[model samples]
Target: MKRTLVFGDIHGGLKALIQLLEKIDYSKNDRFIFLGDYVDGWSESKQLIDFLIELSQKQECIFIKGNHDAWCQEWLENDVVNDIWFLHGGKSTIESYKGIDSSHKEKHLEFFNEMKDYFVDENNNLFIHAGFSSMHGPEKEHYKTNYSWDRTLWEMALTMDERIQKDSLLYPKRLLLFNEIYIGHTPTLHYNVEIPMQGCNVWNIDTGAGFYGKLSCIDIESKEFWQSDVLQTLYPNEKGRNK
Candidate 1:
């Protein structure tokens, strides 16, 4: 059966990604929507991006840009690394690129540059790396970076009174604008839930692979999901957020 799957933050956990695909029995018919931050945390950052570049050639994918992706793109294009980013996995990312061909790096840079900040499918489901600030919708967002940084959208949904009916005026305008909103920047594990989290119509899929949690993917239609082993187990030698 054809399935449209939404993936959460990779955080450079290439092994987890590969393992997740095998577990899902992924096939060409399976559609993938990756919420970014593909590089960082783990030791295979460059390799992970390279694999994704090749995968896109064989399958349908919607790549949403995350804040980490933005930082990686800049590093690729300008050879500059952000001090803050280095402390939070950027050092590992740069290390992964060592000895990689410059030409190969360029292709990865192009892939990052072309990623979308947000995607709306035929069903009007919204796929974004983070959240948007505009109540009018992402199209009218005051700041595009908010697509990969805003937490207000998810926060509103998370804190909404469960008692409020969807039709009630008390409902948030933003939540009413889309059939559903999917995001990844904030890991669901933050709340101590290790699975995909639902807050109203918003879904948080980042299960925290960047740290000790597992990488996750959810079937947008059926809500069935899959996860990799805790990243620490997959890369015992690496400090995938043990720091």
Candidate 2:
């Protein structure tokens, strides 16, 4: 049977990632998909990226760009944007490369730039970094831009109801017939009461691994879910209290 394992946000948790991979029992025939946010929050961003690069060279691996990743690439491309980049989880990412040299930094940026916006299988299983705009339903054409940083379309779609009209609608040929999509970016209900519907059909696998939640992954063909234990606390609990 053809198997594709889709991993959720890493957030620089190399140990957790390694544990999850062990559980999956990776094989030569199976394909692996990373849904982005490979850095930040945890302390192993550089190691995780290096491991991903090595894996990509050996087996089939799909990478999607996340918001944090976008910032990393921007900071690496130009030094002028350092302030803005550091504000968005770039601090931890930079710290991950403390001992590395200029050559390694260039390679890291190259890898980040090469990541794809989305990955689709023969069965039409769509894997995107972040959730798609509800305005476009699950169509591919609506996902032309990098969703990692684009919020205009998403913000508009969030306010509207969920409905795909045949007429006066933009639907991509690739997703017009697909049954499901797998994505990251938006956290699940575990983090917030009003879970964003923009991630709905997007099969959110993020699960806020680096926050007050657990890491998640799923088998596209089986719809079977797997999650790692909550790594640590990220914020105060409800009622304005700390845990």
Summing lDDT over every window of 10 consecutive residues in candidate 1, give the lowest-scoring window: 100-109
CA deviation > 4 Å runs, candidate 1: none
lDDT of 2 at 209: 67
Please, what are the lDDT tens digits per residue for candidate 2 over residues 126-150? 7777545534443444555446644
What lDDT does the true structure give each of the candidates?
Answer: 0.92, 0.67
Q: Report the lDDT tens digits of candidate 1 across residue range 106-179.
A: 77878988999899998999999999988899999988889999999999999999999988989899999999
lDDT leader: 1
- Please report how far candidate 1 places residue 174 from its true position, in Å: 0.3
How well does candidate 2 match the true structure, expressed as C-alpha RMSD? 5.3
- Residue pairs clashing in model 1 are none
Off by over 4 Å in 2: 81-84, 134-146, 149-177, 189-200, 233-243
Residue 61 accuracy (lDDT) in model 2? 86
